[model samples]
Target chain A: MNSLFFYISEAVIGMKRSIVMMLISVITITISLFIFGVFLLISLNLNNIANSINSNLEIKVFLKETVTKTERSKFKQAILKLDHVKKVNYTSKNIAWKKFVKEYPHLNLDNLFENSPLPNSFTIGLDNNQYILNVVSNLKTFKSWVEKVSYGGIIAERMQKFSYYIKILGLILVIILTIATLFIVVNTIRLTIINRQNEINIMQLVGATNNFIKGPFIIEGILIGILGSLGAVIFLKIAYTFLIIKCNKILPYIPIVQNKLEINIILVSVILLGIILGILGALLSLSKALKRYSFNKVK
Target chain B: MIKLKNISKYYQSNSLILNNINLTINKGEFVYLVGPSGAGKSTILNLLLKIEEPTSGELFIDGVSLLRLKDSKIPYLRRNIGVIFQDFKLLPKRTVFENIAFALRFYNYSRSRIRRQVYQVLDLVGLTTKLDCYPTELSGGEQQRICIARAIVNNPQILLADEPTGSLDPETSWEIMTLLSKINMRDTTVIVATHNRGIVDDIRKRVISINKGAIARDEEQGSYNS
Candidate 1:
């Protein structure tokens, strides 16, 4: 439509008029988003580390000494068929005694053990950490043959709680920053409105609709928001790359978020959040500016 | 036709802008609203534009009551009535062509159509050569011409100019007045609010003089102070 192009061009011109204010808005948004992105990355890698460790914490199902070969084999098959069960390895009493002796080389257990008293055990690996508690509870149901089920109690829950807290704290801080950024954007738009008062008055006199007059301003906010998001993307990429490299060097064995695709996705979300913030700021300031514009100038 | 029946406006309880005023101007009639500063001449123009509603009164144009019109219809109502101001309110950064074409943005006119209309209005105001000049680049008279061109670009049935020649020299004032009169000849009702005694006397038209918030005189072939 004819009006769409006009709105875009006018928005561009308006920004050109108040370029400094626009830059300030962009910088403020970028800083806010960058800090927000840092928290997101931290939470993401924390989850990554927890996942690596949980996969290794397999459930050790110790079997009763009186269980027969057929029953033991059937129990192992049932565990393998469980929804979250990935793999199950059977260790006989002889193998368990040998592994225990190897782990504790200094102890003189030859006389105390008598005839290899260690029970046969089934080591069960699961597909995901979320299934650990449920699988442990399910293993306990085979009470006739199963003596005990242990999957490093309380550690998985503690890791989950810690990550959840980090995410919540990050969300709170980002919200505060977003609010502050919104105020800055509102202030910048106020200056733009004042700068373009003459044009607005002219538009009003020409019988232009309020939407037509306000279109450029809304577009200005969106543009500033988009620009700010791009700035954040660049800053996040550089800062994350540097931090990731340093983390790898300092804690090489620790798992973290190093994949390119995941980083890209987070950046995309930040961009979307920036645009939403921009629109909100624009709408907020516009209502205030327009409600009083004609009243003060045209009255 | 425009009609105001007992129109009154009050900014504050103690300060009444337009006191129980009544007037009528028919279609295609050229009229001058002559008054001293703060005599409520501008207020009358503002009321006609519905920029400010009357505190207590009725305004009718073409037999429709403006007070009864919804807020959403105000823009469409304004489309038929063009207004120019004393300060030649042209966008300073925009070229003369853009300044005139700006008014046509409300409608869905094509680019070429808008260009044609802008050129036509510029020619009508005898400033076709200054199409690309910015407002600052033009003289006082030329700037006012751009303002007029923008006002009439939409082919509005009524044009209200508040002190259109307030900042011009005597010759330039005559030039602007002549253009307005020429546009009036085309059957567009013209209402100019001014206190220029020279132009009012020289150009014979309906003049309405206001003292305070009430009409002091309304006469055909009226002068500045008669």
Candidate 2:
């Protein structure tokens, strides 16, 4: 306990001695973490939007005009039993025609045709978007009852491809940003170690053990990390909240992850990332410094 | 007790810092190592502190062989041996009290114990009045006294002083020598390496003179010269 206090005091003294350098390190860390937070927010929102669109996608199965009500009900029951099938709503030809006319008001259907051109169709909701291809293929196998099965095949394929690309791009960006942040942090810590060369020499000459000397330095590094993380979290919170308000005002239709739970998750992850990066930077620099100047050889 | 047998230190294939040095010093003895500049005086001190490994030889302090000692054990060995340099090597930012306290902190001493021990050493070195003064604020003699206080604060069994009074006036040099004698009286072996002929003559301690990296003369109650 006494040693811990001593280590902390020593670290504080070291920090005080190089206040400007320490501040620069902290600020650099803050900026890097903030950038990382921004990237995370963007990726999260893109994911949310993709998921919303996927959930709304529904498959339309058109039946033959001669199909009876009993056959249509049986078809609906079979679709409900299929994997990933959530809900099935049967639509009669009359109802389909009414919905079609309501969707396209310019077409005067009464003058164009006496009978409805639309066929009976069943609207199929799915538990998961990944099963869209499988369900579509399975519906095609029901050739006796289904006249046509369409789930916007081209659009669905394109959306899935786009979602995959977004994930890959987000991953690549995160890795690149994290590495850049680590490099900056390592360089900052190396500078701090260089500045304290004299102090470290004195400590070794006084017969301090390796751990005794390294404890304060490691603690100093951890403190820097925690402070940088705290700064990033505060900055990110304010910036994110402001961004949410501004985005809502400008683009009301854009879907974003604005819930408190999701924002908190992002905040926690950024703080954690900051801390890990800080520690790694400190360890790398400290080890390099230690190698350059062996504590066992004081002269 | 300290013993060195056939110690040889080489910087390169051709250059030797210390060559085939054999010596011993028992407990509670005051000894002076006298030699000219670059005559391996500092190298010997370095060897005692294990700051540099010998090209070849065995060194034993208090019956433990240092040749095979692990690097991790060096600090503990150093705690048993105090070292004083000509420059005083005091942390300029630390006060006299803190400078002395620095040695004890390595041993996991409680704050109260460290405070007590630091004050005790400060009083011994007659610097209790200047406990809070930084090294920059102290005179050369006072700074050297604080260095001595730091060296002895841990109650080390052996104290090695390498030209400790080299930077002081003759009077201040005498004062530092007298303090070292006082420390020696406490059953701590004292070894002072110096080029000062006057103090070496006046002290009349065991003097080992070295020339060309080897001991040239060893005398009892010897003067600076043969």
Candidate 3:
């Protein structure tokens, strides 16, 4: 006879025995994990925004459509010769049109142009991005061949710093929320133990082992934790997918996490953490209660 | 059989609960422990139950030295014994049937077997009609009967009743005593601790009287004062 099924059934019975308490526990975990996940999503998107802005910070020297290949090579070499210049990437007119089409497949450039009129451009990479303004100033000497010399302004740098602070602050808040979740879980389990103290004494009096006594409470913790995490995961999934679709329509260039697999992986990690903490909380509260409670009285 | 040899229990290292004691009760015996309040009648039961350690002695249950028993084996030890309390410790929320079925859980009995055994015990206690009644709904006598049904449902070899009739009237107490006597006739050893002099004298069983922390008298077929 497998006792596992029996014990698990006992845990289920216990859950139904006091549905209100169980609901309180589940709701607590759900709200906590949901808040934690919201912070996580915000931090991830902030990092994405910072990267997008940094990519735009590089100086772009758009060439006049009439420039020869030999002139392009000379211009690239001259740009590389500048202080703090790391490398130069050259994009042809046709390649730029293809890139634009890939980024916005819905927007047909053909409707706006008779042909691929996109200009060939050179992107300058610098060893230190703080020298972007200086490089942009140097490109002025070649105004005859250059259509435009543009780089992201001071706002890009500010956004990078802002996202960095958000990342650090998000980390601290996540740690605090995790601790709070554990404490709340532990307290909830402790309260359950107190409520069932009479039942526990009866169990002991009738020859139930310590493990048998602990089985249901541990199972309760796991169920509560899992439910909480799953609730948060489901909510995040629906809300995030909707937010991503809306953001894509309103702010098309903003890169938010829209990958289904990535989101599932994150949710799975959250559930695993919830389970581990649930078991820990159960064990901690149970040990204290069991030690305090002898056969019929609390010591 | 149960035995206590040179058993001494103390509290906080100085306040003695039970002084050097030696006692033994054979199988198929009905023994009464009678004394005044705080005479340590309950402490002896506590020691035998292993709820508290005998501070300085050897205690044995069914020929096994309880001192040498591993902590893990205590539950198994308890399985061989049943305890009935005065206050009728039944879960207020549970029906009489559920209360009896709870004791059979350690056996991992199937649902049919559990229901069958619970019915059998309830029949023996004569409360088969009140199976669905909760403790709160049952009369005091009926509640104690439910507790008895729960205790004996497992068919333990030894039964320990600590002031089992303390909360009952004389008639109900006699009725409970008659039921315990019926259980004892079926090869179960029954040890009852009580301060009720009327029940002790009328029952005419082996009586051990304690005063302060030591046994003051031990007699067979003893009345309350003999």
lDDT of each: 0.87, 0.83, 0.84
Tens-digit per-residue lDDT, A259-280, candidate 2: 8898888888877777788778
- lDDT digits (tens) for residues B170-219 of candidate 1: 99999999999999999999999998999999999999998889999999
Which parts of model 2 are misplaced by more than 4 Å?
A60-122, A126-167, A259-262, A295-299
Interface RMSD of 3: 3.0
**DockQ of the two-chain complex in candidate 1:** 0.47
Error of 3 at A73 (Å): 5.6
Instruction: Give me the overall lDDT of model 1.
Output: 0.87
- Tell me the TM-score of model 2: 0.83
After aligning candidate 2 to the native by TM-score, how far in Å is the CA of B189 from where it should be?
1.0
Where is model 3 more than 4 Å wrong at Cα? A1-21, A42-60, A64-95, A113-118, A123-168, A295-299
Candidate 1 wrongly placed segments (more than 4 Å): A51-151, A242-249, A258-262, A296-299
Interface RMSD, model 1, angstroms: 2.0
Docking class for model 2 is: acceptable
Residues A149-170 of candidate 1 have per-residue lDDT tens digits of: 7775476567777889999999
Output the worst ten-in-a-row residue range by lDDT, candidate 3 chain B: B46-55
Clash pairs for candidate 2? none
Fill in the DockQ of model 3: 0.47
Please, what are the lDDT tens digits per residue for candidate 3 over residues A38-77? 7667767776677777776688889998899899899888
